[model samples]
Target: MAMTASTAGRRYSNATYRAMRRLKTVGLYAGVAAVLAYMLFPYYWAIVSSTKTGQALYQFTLLPALDFSNYWQLFNNPVFMGALVNSGVVALVSTAISLVIGILGAYALGRLHFPPGRMVLIAVLMISVFPQVVVLSGMFEVIGWLGLYNRPSGLIVSYLILTLPFTTWILTSFIRDLPKELEEAALVDGCSRLRILTHVLLPLMGPAIASTGLLSFILAWNEFLFALTFILTDENRTVPVAIGLLTGSSRYEYPFGQIMAASVTVTLPLLALVLVFQRKIVAGLTSGAVKG
Candidate 1:
């Protein structure tokens, strides 16, 4: 009788333990869900507000009314279109230039043993952290000297200051983690350093390049201060600056719906890029961090 009682008690205890574990798992998932909702709520609201119009925009509701007139109106705006084109051109050009320079610089930093290499890396990191406002006056002077003020090219040049440091740092860390043997073998096969970089490292570093390039593009695309300061003409302004200057038909009213529509329009491309290259981004970031 005692043996049977003990067996029953063990079964009850096992069931209780499982119930506790199940509750813990449920609680963990709930916590994660709550955090995700909190972070995503603002973006969701922006999307919802973009679809509302007139009196409907004033009402607070979770559901969208499916009115896309605001988007049509935004699309028809010449200033917004010009800004969008300028943003694309500046971002693409800046990213390309930065990537080329970053790849070569990172390779030299990672693979070549030279004096004060660590100091150079540290300096690059310091440059990344320097406030943009501190350099604004100096940059404006330089832009004027170069005759690039009020041009998309000027924004491209200014964006380099933002994109180059992080790109070089990330790429340096990534390249440092690559197998040295491959590079040595390329050298043994009578391949030049430039050849090795173009053929050997370039193919192998696609994920890291993709991650870095996307980040650089995003930074340039979202840059406002430099664009605002340098671009005197509406045609040369980027999306962020253009969005900031968005005004209603009347001076008294704020165009919240139009603003939200423009926000969503600019945000979607970034979202698509992130979603498409998410795995590569995660792999590149983790590999650089862990190995270095």
Candidate 2:
């Protein structure tokens, strides 16, 4: 009887311990979820706020209304439309140019054991991080001297500083992580460097390309400082500067509805891209660290 009682007690203690451990795990996950919700609430609030009519906006409405008034105002406003076009042009051109250059450069660095390879990469990183303000004067002088001031090309040139280096470094890391045997076999078959790069290497770099291109698009799309500093004309101003500088132009403070509408409008393309490429993004981001 004594042994039976002890055995039963042991079983009960073990069950209690397991239950407490499970509760602890659940509590931990719940805490993490709460933190994530706190972080995301502002963005959620913005989505809700953007849909609210000007009167309802400040009235503490929690739910986003199913309406098109804000969308209509955003589109019908010429300044918003102009800013949208300028932002699109700048983002598309910069992303395309940076992709071309970054892909070629990344491939070369990945394949070649050239002298000063590490040094070159370090230099590129330094150039990418050098402040937009530091280059402001030189950029202004060059653009003005060449008569490209207030032109899209001038803004494009300025944006390269924002996009190119990060794109190259990221893609270089990705290319380095790809399998080496394919390149070796192609080289052994007497394929030239260009042919091998075009056929064997690039074909396998779909994830890297998608991630890098998407990132480039985001960077160029969101850049404000260089856009503001480089382009001064109404027709040429990128969305950020247009939205940001509006406060100075209006006496009663810029319209919150207009600003909110513009903010959401500019954010839609990027937001959509993020949603569409969500899976690709995760794979691209993790494959380098995991597979490498």
| Clashes (N, CA, C under 3 Å) per candidate | 0, 0
Model 1 alpha-carbon drift over 4 Å, by segment? 288-292
**lDDT for 4 (candidate 2):** 100
TM-score of the candidate numbered 2?
Answer: 0.90
The residue pairs that clash in candidate 1, if any, are none
Best by lDDT: 1
**Which 10-residue span in candidate 2 carries the lowest summed lDDT?**
246-255
Tens-digit per-residue lDDT, 86-203, candidate 2:
8898889989999899988998887798998989899889998998889889888987887878888888887888789999999899888888898899889999988988898888
Candidate 1 accuracy as lDDT: 0.92
User: Which has the greatest TM-score?
Assistant: 1
The CA lDDT of each predicted structure is 0.92, 0.83
The digit string of per-residue lDDT tens for model 1 on 104-211 reads 999999999999998999999999999999889999999999999998888888889999998999999889889999999999999999999999988989899989
